[model samples]
Target: MSKEQGRTWDTSLFKRVFSFTKPYGGLLAIILTIITVLAILGPLRIALIDHMVHHFIEAKDLAGLRTFALIIVGILLGETFLNFATTYLSQKLGQSIVKDLRNQLFSHITKLRLKFFDKNPIGMLVTRAVSDMETVAQIFSQGFLSIIGDILVLVFALTMMFVINWQLAFIVLIPIPLLIIATNIFKKAIKKSFQDVRKEVSALNTFVQERITGMALVKVFGRSKREAKTFSEINNRHKKANIRSIWAYSIFFPVVEILSGLSLGLLILYTLSRVDDPGVNFGELAGQLTAFIMFINMIYRPIRMLADKFNTLQMGLVGAERVFKILDTDELIPNTGKVIKHDFKGGLSFKNVWFAYNNEDYVLKNLNFEVEAGETVAFVGATGAGKTSIINLLGRFYEFQKGSIEIDGEDIRDIELNLLRDNISVVLQDVFLYSGSIYDNVTLGNPEISKEQVVEAAKLVGAHEFIDRLPDGYDFNVKERGGLLSVGQRQLIAFIRAYVYQPKILILDEATSSIDSESEMLIQNAIDKLTKGRTSIVIAHRLSTIKNANKIIVLEKGEIIEMGSHAELLQQEDGAYRKLYETQFDGHEV
Candidate 1:
């Protein structure tokens, strides 16, 4: 949920993560088989060492020594082959799981309601979808199978040591409990540090993404120094988190080396004292001693690295917790009924609507309105008068409480969401263009809209005049967010995009607010052609823009204060519309 929450790995979490590997059952089985064989070879390798020393070297058996050396080489080669296979399969498994998760996250996010995006930062979501999922991938690559193989090797090595010489084996294991205590302490500390690392990474990502998106503002206001200072603080936190993890590693590994040496010392001391005993053949015991030393390395190496691997496992679990939390969030706009098709007559009504973004803090209160088919209606109001909220409600971008919205005398809730939205199109003031060619942006990559239709729609919006001047004409690339295009040019593209949809209802939300007067005049005729014989709702701050509307509704604090034709509203004695026209339009002809 948050950085403050527990990040410890639990059995249930492991089970959940392991479930993702089920699709690769055949590959996972092969990996497990390789680990089992490698584990079984652990004791056999030590036994071979004993044979080569006592029977071949000490007894001077030349042919036997040659044979034993060959067997050792063969074993080494076979182990190498199995290790390669294991590494290859582990990587494949990790990548496959990450691919599935990325697709699912992208699909889920695309379908989520706009309200969800309002609450979560884009940088945080990107971190979860990209970086956090990579941590999950590590659970397969370095965390799960590798740990299992190390443990199996340790288990087999210990079994062989006891079988060879129980007394010496018991002496060699004296430091085990101490090693365990140290490892557990290291694990707890590193888990917290790793969690801190991930938290700092996410915070740093959010800060950088926001600052970069607003670089123009920073430069305009001369706030570069202040912004850089803030970024430095976040980057420093990230560095400290990494250093804390390094401190944990610095303390843990050397302690493991010390305990390993202690074990070796005790084994050597016991073997030397038993050297002269008649029951103990000195040569054979020395070989067993050599094998026992190798066993110590084989055993403790895994034990020591297990703390680090367990830290990876813990970080992965925390990432999963964040990822699944978003996947489990119930923020989707429910699609209940399915209506395949509707011939909407462009009628719309909002009956006694009361709404709020936050609980009970209404932005739209008791709003009642209706529009007949094929009428051009304009909503005029000051900022924060809930003008855009009405458009958002009609498009079903949000749900309202204690009211019903209808289309063509049918409750909009009864209509399928896609079908309802398909019949209405909105052109916002801030037009957003995707990174693509002009034709792609106009048709929005819809296969059903032909190239000829896209050109026709652009001609209607008068966008083709400027578009034809570009080097590639219709194929000219509008790079990221259409940065290469002017605001007026981008708005013209929006008009074409909306026109290509051919909707029954068209909404222009301050659509020409940012455009130059010449561009606005060019688009005015296109707007006249696009809205003819269709229900059009226009929201504008400029009084001159909506003067020709069939009806104008004046709003104040979410209530309809005046409704009439433009001339009728202006004729009222000291009316709100007349006052707004005087204050906003001044000398501009209307």
Candidate 2:
């Protein structure tokens, strides 16, 4: 478990959380009314019992006793109904708020720039969207409104106690100060425990998610035991944190019971002392004593629950603090451009562009390049030579720190974000396919592309043969991350997917590097057909792959070293592209 921070109640944070309840204001009002009624009913029930003892039971009037019994039962039934309504309505309100909050959080996450995702772990985000959201819901179902009802019960119970017998009320409250001190200690200790538990939960989730996703790597490296040891350590810390909270509850609840027992003992002792008084009316005194006993229970129960409820509220506020932090983040890419264009000529240019994933560490420094409409340009470089970064910039996944990128003579930043991306299709080396039918993966749930369109695209890309051979044809499930398909097959599906979109610009980033020679030939043929009239950018490690490119640009250390047709670059014996080609081809004829 991590070291716990000092937790203090922020009233402003509480108010912010309360704001989610605005949409269900009417239901909340009804719940509040029900709570108020419930509070009064507890005290009123005790008074009625006292009345029956004094008037009916003492007089032995059977008819009066029956009538009073029926009235008391009726009140109990009404109270029960009110309690049920409060529970149902409060939970309904909580779930509704959670639905809205989850939707907003997910939508906000989608709008955040790719840079934000680079810094945040997916598992931690899952915790925020899943577990922490449920915690916020409890703010309504079990924390906020419930605390209010407990307080009201306390207030009403104390008032009735004073009304019935002020002296006895004072005697019973004598142990309350000690209870308060104990409760304060428990609350502080438990708050720290809750914080520690929450942290460990996130850590555990992150560890498990990462390990499971990379389980193949772990097994191949024979690190299962080592990973298990690490997981055990994290799980143990989570268990220890929970145990500490449980220990606090164990000590605190017994302490509450002891204090309550002490109050009852004092009440009994005081009544016994007054029994011998000559002027005391024994029946009336008996009735008051009975009412006082019931009132003591009413006061102490909510008092005990108040401590727990207050902690629930505190936990919820802590969750809200974390959630609101995400909501308040200004990392979203501003899509303020009003220009929406469907037809793109795909003339692209980069003018003195500078970019860095981190501050001042330029990955693409002062880069300048241009590709006229319908021309296919290739970027040939070693790993980290800023090949992928250019694609990311074109799609506006990450904003460049300086200079401008334009599409068809207009700054891409001024073009509507969706429209800008919609006109481009990229086939990455690592194709990600959702767990669904092949057809679904191809269309990406786009209703505009019909089954006939998907089939046609698959055929055009030569992916139709393999897809047709599958047991379910186009309906075959790829399982998680396309695990059911070979790397080449997944790449073919990616080609089909891109082709179906009919984008104005196409990008192939090492798309054929991992595939077999046969698959590469198929993909190459598909690429030739797809890039016919569209402006295309190709990033490749295989020199032969881009031999036919209209322009081949060689990059080293974020700076372009050479640019020309493959044959022209080959003519320069010492040029970067020529040297790279020689290394790959190794004296083989071009």
Candidate 3:
């Protein structure tokens, strides 16, 4: 068993996992049958050796020996067939389970609210989805099945031994209890070592991921040596964990092998002595001893295999517990309703909303504003002025407390999540690109988009010029968050993505800050066309970006301090907008 963590695997977890196997039930049954046949054949093959040596060898008849040889050959062939069947079916089932787990974990993770991610490390979450799931799958395939097989076969072997010679059986059984105790002790030690190793594995994965993701930052700061040292420390930790596990295994295997070997030797010696007590023929006694030794050896494999499986299952359970911890986290923002499909007529209103991240530290206080359909509104403020928080609430990324935000006359929360989100889109401050062709990256999952539309949108934001210059143009792969593209180019493509969606409510949260001045001019034109007849909210510090807005609202600590046209706000000699204009925009044009 894994040490008590905050979460542990409920036995019911297995039932939940097996629920995926309903479709593969027929294959599972066949696999189990093969395992049973293999188990039976293993002991029977040992028993056959006794019959052959005792009866046929003494007759000095070549025909009889040939008959036994044929039986042995047939058993070998049958075992081989059964082994092949088990391996293939087990692989199929394991892969199926892993695929289901990966998809389920991914879907569930995406459904979870942002707060869950805020508290949990992404490295740990990723470990659960990929590495941990693999571990559980191995347990389900080999650990789970072989444990049952080992127990059943061990029982059968003992029953046969007792029937053959009860006294000799007692000698072999003496070491069985000690072996069980040793296995348990080693398992505990191994579990601790594995838990440490598993944690280190997650740490290494996280470090590597973050390092690669932020390679530019590291290179800019010339922190390569420091980063390499940090990685070496985690790598050493992982190595130490593995070494400890190897030690436990080293100790455990030798003990099991010695005990099983001792049992075999003792049985052979005792059986030879038994010949003097009865009319047991010397050949028959030798045959029984040989059979007993072979059976002991055969049985040791299952015993050792079971112990190994148990160790692996424990590690997998630890992983599952970690995964379930993420799955079980309270969805900080719950969307409760069928997906609504009502299109917004581009109206937006906030009713005296009071909001906070947690229980305290209110970011937004009693505040209100409304924008008419097809209106463009701009929000300008310094960092931590609650500009982005409002955007997040508008998109339902987080829920606001103490107020109602309405879209098209209905409360946003009352609208079905799908319906609400479908009517709205946000081009966030951070531009993220996936590893795919530029066209694929631009269109995202919107399959209805045509190549012409993708190119049109790209052209709208000046992304097409450089894209066409690339070796494969729109077909060029982005390669991991557009690492191959300039940041300004990536931002332009992201803008095009937001425009292509043609949302009723569009929120640009500092979406164009990374773009060059020339591209910004192109994006401004694209924004004009895109925001036509839609509710558009722009958050920006650059005066150049918001000059065309119908109203510019200046926020101070989540409260609207000034709301009016750009000209009116600029005219306010003592307004917060003028102060921001002086400090941030300075000589830049409005």
Candidate 4:
């Protein structure tokens, strides 16, 4: 179900898959060599049966018969051991390749631009990262090396059969061409069916993951029945897609079985017809016929399994196409700059910046502003006035269409993205806390920051009191998104996190909007300490909170209509900031 382009069964795709396996070349070489050996040894057991009949059974040599029985047992043991090794090694190799691939997918996705995530669903990405990867692994575990063994066995079986008795070999292989043709047709049909199955699987996973995540919302909206119906529809489509693959397999295997039976019948008929011929030895007839049956199975078994193997290959290729599409995507923000030093003094400027999520509809149009080092600038605006967008641009989370942003006199594009982001800290209105201990959440797994440092930062942000009151103190686990914590508590934790980082440029995007008056006062005190000597950008909805800011930039339609100190902006009779201040902080002296 995604409109993502798929790869055809092409050599290029195989090359990409094989590149991952190249590191395990020694192991693969051993597997392939053992497979070739197995192919050669496969016919030897049939030859042993022939030898037993001609040299031991008919000749009435009990000693020779005992020896032949022991040799057969020995061959079976050897084959079993080798077979186990091949399977074990193949699976191990596939798992290793998948591990590397999954890591790469995760890393690449993390590096991709925010727009890619905006366009793609998280559930669909989960399918690609997890389920699709398993299918890709199956290409090696069940399809690649096994196919090689099957093909080699077929080749060796045919060669040995022809060498033993050309006439019988020809008769036994009479239906092979038809089997090959049928398999080819089946390959094409099954490939398309497999693609359909994979698509449905992705759709099903996407539906389930999204529904589960939004289960609470569904219940609140009283649309549980509607969602269930939608889920059932998706589930049924997945089932139907699987059944389509099953149907192809069902039609194909029986046809292969019939062809195999026909080959055996032809061999028997041809051998029986040759009984009166002078060149035919009646003594070896039984032995030769037994060997011919083994040869037929060896050749036809691979032919039968080719359809299944081809199906596996197709599923993997489709999965690979989806994965490679992400890997190959050029939508990543190019990190061409090498500057790693982030000791910024925090003078920032946006020079005639134009931005749009989609190119046609501009959100921020020709916006220009400047903030001096250690200045706290508060942006006041209506909801869509591009306030939060400014923080996003400053952090380089998304790319702007036109113009440039400079930090500490260096163009943002020239400054390394990580370095630029490292010097800037953003505390959004909605704080996201990972599932970890309070200490870990504050430090964010940074080994450089000690527990003492975490405690000190929490105290500085006024988070230490509540954190210390908890059973585990700083070690208290903040469960999913800090669900156990109150909104004020989470905001305090976020303040602690930002404080611990000690970024040169601090951004509070309505950071205290959800806090109660008590918590807001504490946060306001923390903000004073936090923004003492840093470039701080504040986007606030509560006009009273930003009255003492060094500068207030009031935005409307992506451009500044008023820019001055809180008192100076209030003096303008028709200013937007004055109207906003009057409406929100009315009768309260600045």
lDDT of 2 by residue, 1-590 (tens): 33225646788988888888898899889999999999999899888888888888888989998998898999999999999999999899888998898898999999899999899999999999888888888888999899899999999888988898899899999999999999889988888888889889999999999999999999999999999999999999999999999999999999999999999999999999999999987777788889889888888888888778788878878887888888988897779777885468989999999999899999999989899999999999989999999999999999899999999888889999999888999999999999999999999999999999999988998989999999999999999999999999999999899988989999999999998999889998998888999999999999888888999999888989889898999999788887787788896955
Q: Best by TM-score, which number?
A: 2
Q: Residue by residue across 430-512, what tens digits does model 1's lDDT show?
A: 88888999899988879999988888988887888899999899899989889999988998888888898999999999988
Writing each residue's lDDT as its tens digit, candidate 4 over 312-394 gives 87678778878998999878888987677766899989999989988758888888889999999999899999898888888
Minimum summed lDDT over a 10-residue window in model 4 is located at 1-10
Off by over 4 Å in 1: 1-7, 587-590
* Model 1 residue 141 lDDT score: 84
Pairs that collide, model 2: none
Q: Give the TM-score comparing model 1 with the true structure, all chains together.
A: 0.95
N/CA/C clash count, model 4: 0
Name the top lDDT candidate.
Answer: 2
Off by over 4 Å in 4: 1-8, 272-280
The predicted structure with the larger TM-score, 2 or 3, is 2
TM-scores for all predictions: 0.95, 0.97, 0.95, 0.94
lDDT of 4 at 61: 95
**Poorest stretch of ten by lDDT in candidate 3:** 1-10
For model 3, how does the per-residue alpha-carbon lDDT over 469-549 read when each residue is reduced to its tens digit? 998999999898888987677777877887788789999888678777876776777677678778899998787788789
What TM-score quantifies how close candidate 4 is to the native fold? 0.94
Q: Which 10 consecutive residues of model 1 have the lowest summed lDDT?
A: 1-10
lDDT of 1: 0.87
Clashing pairs in 1: none
lDDT of each: 0.87, 0.90, 0.81, 0.86
